[model samples]
Target: MEKNELKTTDSDNGHSPSETEKHLEHGVPVDAVNLPDPDEGLSEEERKRIDRALLWKLDLRLIPWLSLLYLMSFLDRTNIGNAKIDGLQEDLNMSNNQYNATLTIFFISYSVFEPLTQVLLKRFRPSVFLPVIMILWGICMTCMGLVHNFSGLMAARWFLGLTEAGLFPGVNYYLSCWYRRSEFGVRAAIFFSAAALAGSFGGLLAAAIVNMDGVGGKPGWAWIFILEGLATVVVATLSFWMARSCSTEKMDLQLTICQVHDFPDEAKFLSEDDRRRVIRRLKLDQQSSAEHEEFKLDYLWASLKDWKTYTGMMIYMGVDGALYAFSLFLPTIVQQMGYKSIHAQLLSVPPYAVAAVVTIFIGFVADRTRMRGYCNMVMSLFGIVGFAMLLGSGSPHVQYAGTFLGAMGIYPCIPNTISWTANNVEGVYKRGISLGFVIGWGNLNGIVSSNIYRAEDKPRYKPGHAVVLAYEAIFLLGGSVLQHVLLRRENAKRRNGERNNWVEGKTEAEIEKLGDKRPDFLYTL
Candidate 1:
């Protein structure tokens, strides 16, 4: 098809000629619908003003609620560590291995179900799906308080993972739907830093909750589960009113190319101008070849075949393994530093707090510089140094300082890594599957992490520190370098018009089915 003819037909799929003329009056060219350059007619000042307003609206409506939901998710997931120091193991007559097994069981279910849940999230809207799962997981977390034995705790944990499986990947996919690739890092960081803050808050909250040891014939550990779980249930219920799904139908109409499912438009929060500006920018940001596809299993299979998907998964696995182990076992690690259990919980706060601030800072810097791979490598170095300090020193003060370094290093990398993969992949279905697969496989690290820090390796837990440090050096650091090199080489190849053998003479539809492997699709390094 001729370029102009294709553009007109695509535009007619969603927008009328009158709408096209209206956009043209505001400086958008009707024939330039999917042009690589956009905002050509707006003044610099006007563009800045519009962007500021749009960002403010998005931040106000989206970030706080998503952060809160993630905070609750992280709390419910890791509060078991807090409950452990409060005597959960003793009450249930569990050994250290059995307790670790409970943590492992959660990840097993979590890893297995995450991809399926992402599919479900697409079938049901996020507004309906996210809250329903939150309520169910809330019930499961609350039930953990009532469990009297190892089998009961295991059952509660298994179900908790099943219910909570969709949240992280679902949220990532949702953010991708709204933001440009270049603009995604800071927003993702803001959302993910909640997990770090949750660590800090979980510690402080556990310290306070553990004091209710004798209230109403319930132990401190039981109270921790009961109170936090109830809070999640209440918040989930409230989310039914607060959560708004970005209308895919509106997005479809604006893009003129992508065909989206007919969703009820809930864009009342946005003014007409702001909404148009947002949509125009998003259309410009998308690759023209990837613009019109609907959700399909072919997209999923294409993503699975992309080698970058597995490499990204490796990076996520290494970093997430260290993160999960640290969050799940930090209190115990602190207690081993010669402090009482209560004191240990309080001491856990400073590192996480510092990490939270550093995480935000890194996010901003990463977005501004557009250097995710370099940022990831530098952050991984912080973790490597921190672990080295912990293993090298015997002093509590030095060990504590190491925690700060470790927290800053690992926490920032989580968002960067997520955005890194999200930024590179195209197509909604392909992006969804790639994210779900990366996160789901990455979480298997939780299983590996849970087993690494045994009671046998108490006090220093040198083996645990050593294992995490090696992963930081090899996978996190080395993987980023390799990814950067590979992407650069691929871009160079495309610039030279060197198509892969399989791509020759393929129909446009078949080539589009190639997703990220299209010669024009450049990887973000």
Candidate 2:
């Protein structure tokens, strides 16, 4: 069989060569040089075959492992709530306020250290950086089993938060590096569904683990921490050999790796044509040949200055506040509604399971339609209705159904928001910094969530539910709408030849230095 020929063209999105040349001569920045139109070189049948095979291979290789890693990270982080019901607070003689303080302290460290860790991840190789943090946090989680007092548990949790902060943002930046803007939603959704799955399975796991309370002279809650932490260590060790780092080549190409900074352009796992097609598609989508750009403080500054970054942070904060509150308190709320401890744990599973499925479906549709903001807005309505039901009703079954609406609504919005910001942002360092800052700032809401559901509020927790509901409304109706409008206006400006002053007469290197402010870059709505 003959290999396909690769073709490149100077025209981009209907811009003529003379027009581009005229713009360049007039000190106006032009988009990518020589964008490859890969589809023109192949028969439609061949293109379809390659697309299906390549995407399938990429999805199989990337999504499952990343999802599993995140699932474990979430499980370890939030399992304390499950353990609290299993007697962690009582055993440590912690008051309700002190217990809330412990949760708040973790987010304090997590929010503070997130950007720093992300910067370090960019400095180092992900294969090394990701697994190393996992191991460290796994150790910290294990140490939680040994803490006999509130102070000891607090110290352990603080360290765990520091270590775990990098994974979520790091994964978002990682996915953006490999996939095009349109392809990112589903991948991010699949990866984020792990958190929902963790909520579901964590409850079931706790229910079972608590049964071993009297085993080995340790409490069941202690065993829960120890066993889950040990499992994380084992997975982290395996990930050292399993997880692949971002490609080092100027054009992004997917390849599996076992160590730091190893990205072979022609790997044995893929055909030569397959590799070329992947690189071509990514280059055209990004409108640049470079995937791994040099890190600069200016990129970080640019991201900080970008209004989208702050708006994105606000959206995440609203959703995260509700998510953490519900995840941590659902079991307690269920128990308060006249259920036994074990029964509450079991009941928590169904809502999360339903959420996991809904999140994936929403992600698939969002990617297909390329309408992240719209999807997020609709999903948030589910949560608002759920909260309204809880607030307006006195019936137990009705409130139980409310949990399903809440989970389905809130969990799917997380991945959509993440991919929305990731899609609109340009440049590797800028995206990384934006993601880190957004996630870090978003976590500040954890402090609010922890305090809102006070022990005094007990069963109905109207104040906590109301606060979360209001935040969700702001995110869905206000923040997302504003962001979409801003993005559309910016994209129109780019399309209409309204150039940024900094980009004029600059080389590709100089233009890239402006990060997302490059005149040719278009923001995704």
Candidate 3:
């Protein structure tokens, strides 16, 4: 309701917020952690070296475990592709409609639950909430193994969708809480690599697990669910400890209080020095005083009202339509390429494996160059070319090669887009909502892709390939070109002081609340 109609109470100062926020970290007590500051008795060179080491340590503790969680989440969600080829349809006596319904229903719930899960993730502890829901989903997957009828299968899938919805968006917000924007693309890529790896590993594992078809009188499809689902439960149990402070965190961008819930003194893994350095770095990197902000409905509304959120949604849709369709049907597609079911499962592994490596490589490139948009666009071209090969070529070998190119191009764009969106935002609640909707709405395309790859379009499913290719083209233009150009122009306007009047005469607190809109906050390309 003020002049700009966008001010919050935190933006009352006339000076840069960081200048005043140097020591005011997100509510972590200095004395509570019981260790000396890493800044003490150190030169700048020494301090930088120590900070680098600390980051590596944090990487070791965080990325691998989180990657595992994502791997399981992706595997459980998409492994049905493997199950379908392995006799789930014949064993369950399902018609084409029934099977597609299962896939469609899962995505409907998956998409619908994502935004709500994001809000809940913000309000609760990550360690408790993420793991608990993971356990529930694991149970759903395990129940999927036990389903003897159509209604039972439907019920299990619906619950699985609900419970598993929290993990992806929740983890994105969680990673954003710790890493700076410059470092975020790489971390998100690494986390996403797990999903790529899941596709590869899922195929390889399915080839072997299917050999157990008659073991305990259970079909291969049921065991795939039972075993993979059980593995998630086991991992969920370990997550309570493996995730450490990550699970208990509130996306606060500071891990000051450690991992032991309300007890700051109990987190044994991170010494006081590490916690101090981490919190200090966050204060420097962040634009807002998150310590002063709380969850408010207004923040959610602010995120929804932003044009960037919808832009991100459409951009993410560009690749996800291909990603979900391709991943969900790769095994079947391979089977249709004149291979046996077992060989199809085996062949599906390499494309995903290549995709995982390319995804990580592109992520680091985006980080080092800070060129998120260009990286996304360039990589997307690979998929565009690949999908064309699949649609135009009649040769099985050429179509098969297209799968690798497609995976390579499509997988990396996901993390790049997500990190770009995150980099462009400031403030906790707004950031969380943006991530949730961007990802959730993007997932709606999964339904589109899944349905298009219908039973009627076997062998060279020309329609499906064409649809994916179209989306890839959109990804290059809308997701990459438009976003890059817009942000680049916005940054130029700020640099030229054209938007300076928005911040003029505003107190520092009011200025702080302007977030990415503030003249000083440069948008990442």
Candidate 4:
């Protein structure tokens, strides 16, 4: 209630009294960004309008551009496969082993760089940081066309990985800055479905681009890399200009889109009252008020100590193992079943199309129901049953149908699992690292998926099918159920005031720094 009293309370809590604590009273937090009550005296109608406008503007401004950014990332990553079929190996005189080595180098670079890039994501302006990396990778992709030997191509792939590593988890963290937990799943699904879009349509795009053969004295395969890489560069360039708000860059006093996007406190497009409304809702939703905490080394390692983060990663690994293995071998498996090479490629399209549609539907439902954990379990069962049918049945029809179930299972499970972790984690810095670690490390499941389907095991690869089935059923489904029970129990403990030690004898500002560990902060189930 008084300045002298505030310092005495904070000193007892073993916290030094500072400027931030001076304004904190008994139970009220002084916002990191000082403001009056954001919604005070507003009519119910006005509050509703501010909420609606914020979501609509963000959905328009953020989702589509992010989807395209991710689309390009997926295209550049996978287009190497298309290049090989278009005579990349023949032109470069590359051995099969050398070609395989090129692919492996990229993954190594990409996986290792993920955790570090998330730190940079927190430090820098995202508009500047994200597009800069896109340009770097696009240049790397373009250089592949000019390479004349195996070593040249390998070098380009490695750089491409280093540059592209940040886009996936970075976008997930970026969206969290603007969207509430309830709104995240569908946007993530839409953003992730860009991979499905790339898988389904990238071949067609490559086919058209490669037709530029001899137009610039390069082979068709070389043109594929050259043109696609240039396209990524062009789109990334336009994103900078689009950073000017539709509300108009000329609007007085507010920062440009790029500057405001650094944090909601700086939103150029939102009216002053509306912007504070956005920040207030987020603080309320998280049940913590440590807005704009300075970056600290402790934030990065905090996620490492949280068991929930590892459980999320292990569960995600189960989904990634099944997803990648199926994607890699689907065409070959179909070819072995007596279809022509081209015919199998065409058949592969339906599975991806089915996956893309189902993944979007799952996101909308997960947000509305808040049953994300149950959704993951249900989806994993689809994969388990799909793999079971493939292993047990002799019918081509049954095996063919298994592909659909597998696609449906793994695609939707990915977004649900990702958003599940994103939903529960609190604090910007900790979330940045948590998502980066969970996604970056989970993708290392690629190693297992890559190996399980040995060449000798083709034409109903029983070993691969069995291995993936166990991963999905045991890890994804089981982990989802386990987290649900644990989180529910923890929520009850907090609800019953059994966790009051966390808040006792602490200044409100010190308590605000607790993030998700605050007793009032319940884990999402």
CA RMSD, predictions in order: 7.9, 5.8, 6.6, 6.4
Provide the overall lDDT of each model, using Cα atoms, as 2-decimal numbers.
0.79, 0.79, 0.79, 0.75
lDDT of 2 by residue, 1-525 (tens): 001111112456664333223334233233333434446668989888878888886676667778888999999989988998888999999999999988998899999988887678766767779899999999999999989999999999999999999999988787776677778888898899999999999999999999998898899999999999999999888777554533334323333432222121333345566556665565556423224567778877889889999999988998988898899888888888899979989999999999999999998998888778888888989999998887777789999999999998799999899998888777767888888988888887888888888889877888988998898898655788888788778767665555545455666666545555655556666
The weakest ten consecutive residues by lDDT in model 4 span 1-10
Clashes of each: 0, 1, 15, 0
Stretches off by above 4 angstroms in model 1 are: 1-44, 243-268, 271-275, 287-293, 500-515
**Candidate 3 residue-wise lDDT at 444:** 79
Summing lDDT over every window of 10 consecutive residues in candidate 1, give the lowest-scoring window: 1-10
lDDT of 4 at 202: 66
TM-score of each: 0.87, 0.88, 0.88, 0.86
Q: After the best TM-score superposition of candidate 1, give how far the Cα of residue 447 lies from its true spot, in angstroms.
A: 0.3
Write out the backbone clash pairs for model 2. Answer: 213-220
- Candidate 3, residues 82-189, lDDT tens digits: the string is 999998988888998898888888888988989888778766766678888988999999999999977889999999988988888888877776777888899999
Q: How does candidate 2 fare on TM-score?
A: 0.88
| Candidate 2 positional error at 276, Å | 4.4
True-structure lDDT of candidate 1? 0.79
Which residue pairs clash within candidate 1?
Answer: none
Give stretches of model 4 more than 4 Å off: 1-39, 84-98, 207-221, 244-247, 250-261, 287-290, 390-396
